[model samples]
Target: MNQIITFGEVLMRISPRGNKKFIQSNNVEFYFGGTELNVGISIANFGGDVKHISCVSNDFIGDTAISYLRKFDVSTSAIVRSNRPLGVYFLEVGAVMRPSTISYNRSHSSFSEIQPEMVNWEKSLKKGKWFHWTGITPALCKGGKETLLEGLKLARKKGMQVSADPTYRSGLWKYGENPREVLSELVNYSTVFIGGVNEMNELLETDFSYSNEDFIEASKQLMLKYPSIEKVFDKIRTSINSSWHKIRARMWNGKDFKETLDIDITHIIDRIGTGDAFAAGIIHGLQKFDDYKTMEFGAAACAIKHTYLGDINYANEADVISILEGNTSGRLKR
Candidate 1:
C-alpha cells in the first residue's frame, strides 16, 4: 500500500450549537479540525494508508485530538508533543442571509512555533509516496513556514508526489512577510496545485482575468513558473442563498481542461472541509481512476461533505462513488 503523508496543525473548534449567535449562546460544542487532518482522514476513510504530522501540546486536549485521528484510522506517529497550548477557534454558524463567522485564538500555539529540526523528516516520510499540505500551514507563523518547507524539500528528495491547496486566508499571515514570496517556494515542488485565479494573482503575482480562457492562460504561466506542477484544480460555487449552492469543479493538466456539471447543494450542514475532501478525493481517484474521472469524483466528494456536520468528510468511498454515478436520490439503502 502507498502511504500518503500530510503536514499541518490539528485544531480544536468550539461552535455554538444550532443557529444561535455566539453572544447569546451559553453552551458550545467542541470538534476537531485541521486542513491536513481533514485530508488525511478522508483518504483513510477510503481505505488509504495516510499519516499526519503535526505539533500538539502534551495535554488532555491533545489526547482527544489524537483519539479523533485514531478513530478515523489515520497514523499519528509523526505528531510531536510539547507544553504549548493547542490551537483553537470559535465558530458561529449562520443561516439564510446571515454569514458564518469565525474568531481564531491560535496565536503561539504549539504548531505555530514548530521548527524544522523538531521532527525527523526523513523517517516520517520514509514510506510516503505522496505528501500533502496547504497554504494555511505556511501562513500560521514563520517557523511553521520553515518546517513545512523542510518537509516539502525532504518529500522531493525522496521522489514523492506532492500536492497543495492554495488556501489563502487573509488573517493568518501576520508574521511580517509577503505571502506571495513565501508560497512560491513551496509551489515550486508541488505536483498538484488546488487553487484559482484570485489565488494566482495573490500568490504568483499574475494578472489573470479569471475568465475560462484567462484561467487557462494563468495556469500556463503557473506551469512555466513551476514545471513540477502536473495539474491545477478548483471547485466553483454559485450561491443561491447562504444555505443553498450550485457547485462544480474544474481541472487543467497543463494540456487539457476538464470540468464537471454543477450540482445543487441545498441546506449546507457544514462548509468547512469540503475543499479538503475534494483534494483527498482527487488524490484517491488519481491513484485508482483516469485523469478526467478525478474531477467528477472530487466534485462528488466535495458535494457530500457539505451534508455532514463537522470538518472531516465522514462519507466513505462507496457513498462517494454512489453519488458520482448519479445516484443522488437520497433514498434509504435497504
Candidate 2:
C-alpha cells in the first residue's frame, strides 16, 4: 500500500448526545477530528498507510487525541506537542427541517500556533506517495500557511502526488491574507483537485454556474490556469433535509469525464466528515482502481459515512466495495 501524508489541525468535537441541543442535554460526548485528520483516519481504516502531522496541546487532551488516531492505526509519530490548548468546537445535531449548528473555539489552539521550522519536510515525506491538505490549514495562521507550503514543495520535489481540497470557510480567514492568492499559490503544487465549481470560482475569480456543461468548462479553465492539476473530482450532495441526503460524484481527468449514480441516504446518522471520506476514498482508489471506478468508490465511501456517528468514517474497503456493488441493504453480515 502507498503511504499518504495528511497535514492539518486536530480538533476536539463536543456535541450534545443524539439530536438534543445543549440547552436540552446535560451530557455531552467528545470526539477528535479535523478536516485532514478525518481523511487520514478514513484512509487508514481502508487499509492504507496514512501519517497525520499536526500540533496538539502538551496535555492529557493531546495525549487522548493521539491515542484516538492510533486506535485507527494512523501514525502519530509526526505529531508535535505545544503549550497551547487543543482546538475545540461545539456541535448541535439537528433533525428533519432543523440544521446542525457549530461554534468554533479554535482561534488560539495548538495547531494554529505551529511553526514551519518545527517540521522537517524532507524526513516527513521520505516514504510518502501522496500528500493531502485542506484550505482550513492556511486560513488559521501564517505559521500554518508557511509550514504547509514547505511540505507541499518537498512533496512535489519528491515526485509524490498531492491532493488539495480548498474548503473555503468565510469565518476562518481573519488573518488579513487574501484566500484566493494563498490558495492559488498552494494549489499549483497539487496534482489532483478535490472540489467542485465553487472552489474553482474562488481560486479563478470566475462566476461559473452549477450546470454540468459549466462545470466541465470551469474545469478546463482551471487546468489551463494551473497546469500542475491533472484531475478534478467533485462530490455533489442533494439534501432533502438534515436527515436525508443523496450523494453523487463526477470527475475530469484531463481527457475523460465520468460521473456516478446518486447514492441516497434516507436516514443520516452523521453528516460531518462525509466529504473527507470521499477525498480519502479517491486517494485510496487511485492506486487500486480505474478512474471511473475510483469516482464510484469515492461516492460509495461518502454515502457510507452517513450511517455512522462521530467525526470519522469507520467504513473499511470491503464496506465501500459492498456499497459499490449495490449491497446497501443494511442486512446483518451473518
Candidate 3:
C-alpha cells in the first residue's frame, strides 16, 4: 500500500469553447489543469491514496480549483494560500500542419513564490512510497527550483520512489537558465523518467533517430547516465491532422523495453492532458501489476483521453481496460 504525492502548480486554463479563435470568442471555457495536479487527480479517481501539494492564490479561481480537487477526493491540506494570483494559460488548438499554441500568464504566480520552509517535507512525505513531479515545476523560477530540490531531497532521504516527466515547454523556462542545465539536475533524482525523444535530445545534447530499438537504446543510455532512474516510459504519436492521429507507447523496465500496437484515433475532442493521462496510467499499472502488459493499459488510457474534453479526471479504468482488450469500434452504451 504505497501512497503517491505530486508537487506542482495548478492553473486555470481558458480555452475557446468551440473552434472559434481567441479574438472571435467573447467567452472561454474554464478548466483546472496542471501537469502534476492532473496526474494526481486521475490517480485519486482510480482509487489511489494520492495527495497534491502546491501553492494557490486566495482568489475565486483558486477556490474553484480546490473545489474541483475535492470533487475527485484529492487531499488539499498541504496547499499554501497566498494573495498572489493563480497562473493562467490560453490554448488555441490548431489544424493541419499548424500546431497548438499556448500563451501562459504565470509570472508571479503563488506557486512560483513557494519557499522550502512552506512545505512540511517530513509530514507530507511520511509513509509515502512514490513522489511525482515534472520539468515544468523546476522551470518556474528560482524559488520553484529550490522548492522542488528540497522535495526530492526529502523523498530520497525517506527512501520513497520518485517519478518525473520532463515535459519541456520552451516558453516556461525564463529564469536565465537553459532547460538542459535545470532539467538534467532535477532528472538526476528521478527513479522513473518519462518524456519525448525531442525533449530528451534537447536535454542530453544528442541527436537520436526515431525507431523502437533506437528509442529503447537511448533510454538505456540515459538510465546509465543517471543511476537513480530505473524505468523509462514514452508515448509515440503520429498526427494526421487536428482531429485524427495514431498513437502508441513504449516502456523500459530496467532490463528490457516493450511497446504497444498503434491505435488509430478518428476524432479528437481535446488533445490536451493526454500525456498526463498516459503517465497516470503508467503509475497505476506499475503500482498494481507486475507485467509488461501495463504498457498497453497506459497507451489505451491515453487514447481514451483524446476522445474527451478537459483534463484527466474524465478518464475511467473501465474505458481503458476496454480499449486494452481491443475494442476500438467505440460502440455506444445504453
Candidate 4:
C-alpha cells in the first residue's frame, strides 16, 4: 500500500480522570489528537502506511507529540516546528444523561500560524496514494486555509485520491471566511465525500431533512454540483445518552445505496474521535472491499472507539474483523 497523507492541527487533550468534571479533579490526564491526526493514527494502527503533516511548537511538548505519533507508526517527516505553543483543548467527559463538553484554546497555536510557503506540497505528496483533510484546518486562519488549499490542488493534479470530511463547527469559523464558500471550493477537488446530509446542507445552503430518501437526494445533488466526488459515506450516531449509543452507516456510490446494521455501544469510555475512526475505516476498507462492506467496516471501527480512552482508535484490523464476525461479547482472549 502507498502512503496515506493527512493534513491538520495537532492538539493536546486535557481531561479529568474518569467522568469527573474540572472542579472535581485537581489533576488531569492528557493525550495527543486532532481531527485529521486521529484518522491518520487510526489508519496506521490498522496497518496502513500513513503520514501526518502539521506544525507544532518548537518545545518539549511538540517533541513528545511527535514521539506519540511515532509510537503509533505514523510518519511525521513533514511535521514542522514553530515558536508558537501547541494547541490545547479541555475535555470534560460525561456520564449517562450528561453530555461531554469541550473548550479549545488554539487561536495563536503553531498549526494555526502555518503558512503555504512552509511546506512543499509537491515533495510531501510525492509518494502518497490518498490524501485526507477536515474543515477544522481551514477554519483556523487565513494562512491555514491557504496552506491546505495548496496541498489539495497539488493532490488533485497528481491524481491522488482525496477524502474530504467537512466537519463544520460554527464556533471555529471566526476567521472571516465564508464556511460554505470555502468548503464548496475545497470539496470540489475531492474524490470521496466523508460526510452526510447535514454537512451537505451546510455546503449547499439548502434545507434537507434527515431521512433515508432525503440522504440519497442530497447525495445526488452534491455529486451533481461537484462531479469529482465518486462516492459518499456517512456514519450515523443515535445517542441514547452520554454513555450509550448506536453506530450505523449508509453509502451511495452513484449506482447503489446501502446501509449497515447498528453496532450498539454501551458504557462508552470516550466518543470524541469515533467519527475519525469511521473515516479511517472507510479509507482502509475501500482499498480491499466493495462499497457496502466498506460502510459496514466503518461502523464497526466507530463502535470500537467507544471502548478506548483516547482520541485515536487503537483497534487493529483483526479487532475490527472480530467485530465484523459478530463477536460483541467482551470475553478474555486468553
Report clashes for each candidate as comma-separated counts: 0, 0, 0, 0
Q: What are the Cα lDDT values of the candidates?
A: 0.88, 0.94, 0.84, 0.93
Best by lDDT: 2
Give the per-residue lDDT digits (tens) of candidate 1, residues 1-334: 2899999999999998987888888898888999988999999999999899999988999998999999988999989987998999888888988888888888888898788889789889888999998999999998889999998998988889999887788788998988888888899879998888877777667677857888888888888888999898888878887799877888899789988898788889988898899999989988999878888889999999999888989989999999988887799878
- Of the two candidates 3 and 4, the one with more favorable lDDT, higher being better, is 4
Candidate 2 lDDT by residue in tens digits, 1-334:
2689999999999999999999999999998899999999999999999999999999999999999999999989899999999999999999999999999999999998899999988778888999999999999999999999999999998899999999998899998999999999999999999999999999989999988888899999999999999999999999999999999999999898888999989999999999999999999999899999999999999999999899899999999999999998888987
Question: Whose TM-score is higher: candidate 2's or candidate 3's?
Answer: 2
List the candidates' TM-scores in order.
Answer: 0.97, 0.99, 0.95, 0.99
Model 1 reaches what TM-score against the true structure?
Answer: 0.97
Instruction: Tell me the spans in candidate 4 whose CA falls farther than 4 Å from its real position.
Output: none
Enumerate residue pairs that collide in model 4: none
lDDT of 1: 0.88
Instruction: Give the C-alpha miss distance for residue 27 in model 3, angstroms.
Output: 2.6
- Candidate 4 lDDT, tens digit per residue, 1-334? 2899999999999999989999999999999999999999999999999999999999999999999999999999999999999999999998899889999999999998799999988889989999999999988888888999999999989989999999898888887989889989999899999998989999888888879899999999999999999999999989899999999999999989999988889889899999999999999999889898889899999999989998999999999989977899999998
